[model samples]
Target: MRIAPALLAAATLLAGCATTPMARTAGPANVPPGMQYLYGSGEAAALSEQAYNALVDSVRAQLAKGRPATAAILLPAANGTSAPGTCGDKPYAAVFDMDETAVLNLGYEYNDAQTGATYDTARWSRWEASGAEKVAAVPGARRAFVALRAMGVTPIINTNRNAAGAVPTARALAFAGLGDFKHQETLFLKGDADGKSAKDGRRAAIAARWCVLALGGDQLGDFTDALGTTPAARRRSVSSSAYADWWGRRWFVLPNPVYGTGLGSGWDDTFPASTRWTDPGDAASVAQPK
Candidate 1:
């Protein structure tokens, strides 16, 4: 999960909105609003539950239609075209991103909040190796796993967590009650395929063996690397007709406001100029009576 420079810049800008003079004086209140909403709010929990429920339903419906002709994964072709992986009697499986999608790294996040530091690769590597006990399964993930297994669908984790920490990563998933994830078999990591952070290669490897019915993650890269880098490009890519209907049908995204590629958007990218509005009154006069 390497944060791009653009995303880092956006995060720094957005941090200003979260940290105010009053917030800085409040001590423990220094936790960013995004972190609070993602890690502490019930709304995020409900959203996770809703996404999992939809995913399960989608899988069930697809299974009812018998074997699929193509996998849910988008495969890039050398001829400048892309298509879903062809399915040929492969076992049914659902691919999911682990961190923030399947489990919450409560311990690492707490430390981060306490220190007010940006993402640190070395620190994250340490957490990956030692933070198993501090993780919790995302809401509804446990139940979703049970339901998927009961329906004869295997749950597979494809995360950007390093392969060197495979043992502890599996432990973290199990600790969070998500069941066992064996390296290279049930769990695929960053160095597992092509040694890149992008997951499309790993996804291709998984799709080659299993008929992927559903894809779940907090970042767009979990599903495909074709999404453009910018905020506007990413939004348009998802909303395009080719993928517009895939949201709740074959792809499920869990909420992750704390951090990710989705966090960095400027004011112009977030709000359209046509929608801008002016108060049309003095602040002192408005505050005098209203």
Candidate 2:
């Protein structure tokens, strides 16, 4: 008879005490280093570039053909992007999320991961203190941004990384060779006087001036979340429109398993051994620190 060893093991462990890794509760100190590696990896950056190019092109084509007025990028990955916000008569504008979307914390992420470390605020500040840090623009991003600018489309940085981050973020953009677009009012934040995470409102504010033509980002919330967190709600929204196939087409999503809602529901969420590989026996017995 085929018996799952993990089932027996879980039964044995729970019988005695909550010793399963999944059951091991976290304390104040277990807040994790956090998955801060969304940026800096060569492969990830390359993918970001590819996504950027595809997105800008999609916007160009749509605008050139006079289709949708605005597009949106969603969240749960990096923040999303949208058609730009306007300044003056510039009706063509693009909205891109800050943080990992435009500029990445690559140096910090790479160094920390290489050492099995966590995100150090001091290091982060130091890295972002200068606008001259060696940051390579995501692949194809420079050309895309430049192309959009040539098309008279304005690009704005909309992010959740706080307005204070706007300066360094701007610097990083220039350092990456992505050139500087606009900051301040152009950089929308989570709690900046706006008092909202509802990007749709933010988009409306932008549209009040310029006509946004498209949007892109790594998450769904970047688009719109009229519905709550119900999975069915999200599926119906994206699947209902022609935008279903628009995932990699117009909505360029760079892979980001780190941070964002993709992680468990909270800081305490973790993977159970049973989640994938065969469950082990006396994980506590095997979990002894080396």
Candidate 3:
């Protein structure tokens, strides 16, 4: 059959639109596990501000007068003691955690979601090899770092990111206007930490040398090693006496709903329909009645 010219044109246009990927719809699961950046950008930004303000207030309060009273040690020493913070004349400090703690590794998760893709070493290497040139500071985080520096407090960025990230990370921080924090040796990566599983060793080291007035990060581990084996342990650690004093007082934590060890095991250990799948009432159904 012969088609009308306008009808043919309309069919072509409709076909093009039909082939396009659908706008992701909301469901019981709107976002997947690895797509926190795509799902939680606002939360991450809010957390960054919280950490920044905590450091600023802690530093200002510490250096106000007589002596450093309240301080959050980044790592405790090997012997379980904190290094005192003193430098000829300078008083206290504030230590920061990189990754979600300081700058959002949002790209890894963000790209995955936007492109409807998954993570792989090859992809991550490309992400890193690109020098993370597009990386940005955790919202207000860099400003907080600079502010602490301005207050005469040492600002240290401790990260788990490998050395390959050093140059790019530094540049990004600089571009974000975070002034230079001397003592070149302080950016801590995984291998740099001592035997202590807890940051005690590092915190102690910093405490021994620098008066850490406050500490900020997304995870509890950044503040103290008290966060234990299980999720419950971690919860307990946060409420424990030693950390009780520091919680929210000398430490500020940013939100990290994307990735962390915090999420309890779900259907993840077995075959699941999707990356973000969670076990339904299946487990409870199998449990014996008490």
Query: Whole-model lDDT for model 3 versus the true structure?
Result: 0.56
Worst 10 residues of 1 by lDDT: 1-10
Q: Measured by TM-score, how close is model 2 to the native structure?
A: 0.61
TM-scores for every predicted model: 0.90, 0.61, 0.67
Q: What is the lDDT of candidate 2?
A: 0.54
lDDT of 1 by residue, 1-290 (tens): 33422132344345456353233233445566667777889999999999999999999999899898988999987888678898899999999999889999899877766655567688888999889999899999999999999999999999988889999999999999999989999999997878878888899899989999999999999888998989899999999987887889999999876678888677888888999765749686567653
Q: On lDDT, who's better, 1 or 3?
A: 1
Tell me, by TM-score, which candidate is best.
1
Off by over 4 Å in 1: 1-17, 20-27, 282-290
- Per-residue lDDT of model 3, residues 73-110, tens digit only: 63434686533334344455677776656665555555
**What ranking emerges by TM-score with the best candidate at the front?**
1, 3, 2
Pitting candidate 2 against candidate 3, the one with the higher TM-score is 3
lDDT (CA) per prediction: 0.85, 0.54, 0.56
Candidate 2 lDDT, 174-256, residue by residue in tens: 78777665554566655554567656666566656665655556556564544346444454656765347657555566655
